[model samples]
Target: MGIDPTNPTGIKAFVFDVFGTVVDWRSGVAREAQPFLNRHAPDLDVSEFVDAWRREYSPAMEEVRSGRRPYVRLDVLHRENLVKVLAHFGIAGACEPEIDELNLAWHRLDPWPDAVDALHRLKRRFIIAPLSNGNIRLMVDIAKRGGLPWDAVLGAEVVRAYKPSPRVYSETAEILAIAPRELCLVAAHNNDLAAARRVGLSTAFVRRPTEHGPHQTSDLKADEAWDFVVDDLHELATQLGCAR
Candidate 1:
């Protein structure tokens, strides 16, 4: 059955997929990496480096999702991946502190221009939080830096599993004390929404066409007929009857 955006009566909460949906992770990571790269591997393309780092994200989490490794926070995985990415680029000799600071780029990501205001508008009518792969601290820092008004922070650390895992979606609803059907997952990625829908949550797709960069080709349009599909958070807010 399809959801009616204008009258989503039972949805008490709106949980977001943060990285590319709410925050521009690719550009933000490249921006934060610029100074460090200039000092280290000046010749390395910042965009390429950021993409390489992002490519490591899912595989690292799969280790935990598959239960091959115990759950460790995203920060730890990012740092470990950072070391490898640095090595891959032949940019050796980065100190521990340097790598640690650079890994924090995830925390400093910028929101889409429509995000903060749309979230605030949505917040007035429903519970709003992140259902991201990022750990608590990472989510908190991103929210703080970007002025996102979340009622609570939630994700991998809280659930002990990364996204696309049924537990991540079902457990989040459990934590929020709402039925899975009463919670909605808003994301730019169809796979994330598909997982949420599989677990009985409503799903919304917000387009971030340039999330991966100008030449990006994937996830430009909704692959499935999600509960709601909008060009940006602002449109979602409007469709959901949020005040200006």
Candidate 2:
């Protein structure tokens, strides 16, 4: 059912997918990597390299989600993935200290221009927190760095499971002291919303087409009939009547 932008049913809180939804991870990562690549490996493509690093995100977490590996934070997984991608490009001579610095780029990512303002608007009507793959400290750090007004920081680390796992959604709702139906998951990724929907949460889809750069193909539009679909976070605030 298409939600009336004017009315948000029972929603008391909005749980967000932080990476691509609230911030432009692709550009943020590439911006950090390009300087190093230009200085050391000028022939390498920055955007392509950043996308390659991002593609490793899900699979790296699967090992932990499946219990094949013990629970670890996204920060650790990010570092591991960065190492692998660097090796894949065969960019030798880069040491662990330098690679680790690059991995921290995820922690310090800048928000989309509208992200902070939108969150401030939404916070007036709803308790806002990140339901991201990032760990609690990581999300909190990013929020502090970017001036995001999150009511709380919650994510995979809090639940000890990656997203798409029912526990992540259900536990987040549990923590917020709200019913799953009253907790809306706002994200740019369809798969994240699909999982949240399956777990009985309300959903809002906001597009971030340039999130993965020009070659991006996925999530150009909402695939499923989500409750709400808006062009930007601020638009979502207007749709939800949260604007002040």
Candidate 3:
């Protein structure tokens, strides 16, 4: 039902989800909290706080994505949730600057083991960019921090809509100067892939079972039949006939 990149098919571009697809935001954010917690709340068990902090991701995104709340960057959403989560844990002693630095942890997420090399291979073969719910600035910051080789960055800010919205996918294609069918949406989230399929964009699923850590309960594997289901981004490059 979708174009296959390795078949010498019509797809010429790949749009990726940045958060979990390319970078391990959960673990990365949690790791980034380690030093600060070690210095401040040495015995506070920041691991639980990290997990609890991530629990708010969906609900926060839904507010902006569903139109119940106005467009807000994920950074702001993370911070908004961070405040509540910190209070919920009764973790105190953080000042404005400290909170600001913690808020930026999302921008410095480490890419998966094979993500960089694979992205380079994919970039060599096609127009590769991020099409995510993250704002352009945040995406750019992450790319720079992670050294991601993206030809361009596309985000919900560009379309004023989020994933699962046809307009977002369509707009990404338009911005890349490619047709919907010529673009493939690569993500770790099934909902994201499903949205691309509905909008006429090919889909590739890169499994990220550990994205939510030990408590991850969903998205352990591809749910819907996707055009491709690679174990990691590097495998995706190889499957697409990319050399090395």
lDDT of all predictions: 0.93, 0.90, 0.85
Error of 3 at 182 (Å): 1.0
lDDT of each residue in 1-244, candidate 3, tens digit only? 6655456757799989988889988788878898878877787776787888888988887887788998877778889998998788677888989989988888888888898888899888799999988888889988888889999888788888877778999888898888898899999999888888988999999889888777788899899889899899878888888888
Which 10 consecutive residues of model 1 have the lowest summed lDDT?
1-10
Tens-place lDDT per residue, model 1, 37-128, is 99998988999999999999999999998989999999999999999899999998788889999999999999999999999999999999
Give the lDDT of residue 165 in candidate 3.
Answer: 75
Error of 3 at 64 (Å): 1.8
In model 2, the runs with Cα more than 4 Å from the true position are 1-8
Best by TM-score: 1
Which scores higher on lDDT, 2 or 3?
A: 2
Which stretches of candidate 3 lie above 4 Å from their native place? 1-7
Highest-scoring model, lDDT: 1
Worst 10 residues of 2 by lDDT: 1-10
> For each candidate, what TM-score against the reference?
0.96, 0.94, 0.92
Better of 1 and 2 by TM-score: 1
Prediction 2 global C-alpha lDDT: 0.90
